[model samples]
Target: MTIGEAYLRIAEDRFRRVKGLGDGTFRQLSERDFYERTSQHGNSIAIIVQHLSGNMVSRWTDVMTSDGEKSFRNRDQEFEPADLPMDLILEQWEKGWETLFNALRNLTEEDLLKTIYIRSEGHMVLEAIERQMAHYAYHVGQIVYLGKEIKGGRWESLSIPKGSSDQYAEEMKRIHGKNGG
Candidate 1:
């Protein structure tokens, strides 16, 4: 594959991996856990998901033509407590991801070099992708951390379980051979 094509694939895979982490955490949380706050000023998973969905919609819609920060997006409101139903929250989350994936799927290798505006500032399409990837990963990490804290002893490992590196490696080697390729 061409460099641009490879980059696009890698970017999509990375984003999917981040999303999967959040999904696993979500499966283990109760509906009430979505709205729980560890501190007075802390954001709940609900708020974080709302903010992410809002961001994804704003940034990915008409990405090549319009500024990422849309006029209608109330970023501040995304942080406020909404006490929304779980289904609605999940719907928003899915909508945001679908918007992002659609944008990525439509992009061409040549488009990666073109400029896109976020707010009033200019960023190359590739730069914008990287920026969003990092931002999303950060928030996903927060969600996972909070889920773990709330679940405490009941939490399951999203990745390799603690103190099992050797076992994990052996299993991988068995599946993928000694070189793991």
Candidate 2:
């Protein structure tokens, strides 16, 4: 297809991968694990979720016109631990992704060439998407790493298990070939 179409496809694919990693990790965690930090100053899963939700809401709400860093967002507060239930935190996580995905779905090819503001700095729409996508990927990596650490040997592999790369490659080839890829 067109360049914009390709860009959108790639962006959506990466976003889905990041979401899957975080969600899969979240499933492996217990309630206490959500609040457990790797260190005294490190972030817990709950805090990471809070920060992500806050960022998603701020950046995606009125994304086409308004500055991405919303005036009402208390970014600092996202780092502070709250006593909210795990379900509530996960609800917020879903809301954030909904907002972000909705915004992405609404984008037109031309919109990618247009400008948007984040923290008063102008960025092309595609650039803005790339920025946020990378940011979320980074945090998702953190969340997955923390989950793996906490679960230790019990953590279910999200992708190939530790020594299964050769088998995974063969399986991928078989599956893709069967689908005419």
Best by lDDT: 1
Query: What would the C-alpha RMSD of candidate 1 be, to one decimal place?
Result: 0.6
Give candidate 1's error at residue 146 in angstroms. 0.4
Pairs that clash in candidate 2: none
Instruction: Look at candidate 1 and give me any clashing residue pairs.
Output: none
| TM-scores for every predicted model | 0.98, 0.95
Q: lDDT score, residue 137, model 2?
A: 91
Q: Which stretches of candidate 2 lie above 4 Å from their native place? A: 178-180
Model 1 regions more than 4 Å off? none
For each candidate in the order shown, give its overall lDDT on alpha carbons.
0.96, 0.93
- Candidate 1 Cα deviation (angstroms), residue 158: 0.4
Which candidate ranks first by TM-score, i.e. highest?
Answer: 1
How do the residues 54-146 of candidate 2 rate in per-residue lDDT, one tens digit apiece?
999999999998999999999999999968999999998999999999998888888999999999999999999999999999999999999
lDDT of 1 by residue, 1-181 (tens): 9999999999999999999999999999999999999999999999999999999999999999999999989999999996789889989999999999999999999999999999899999999999999999999999999999999999999999999999999999999999978
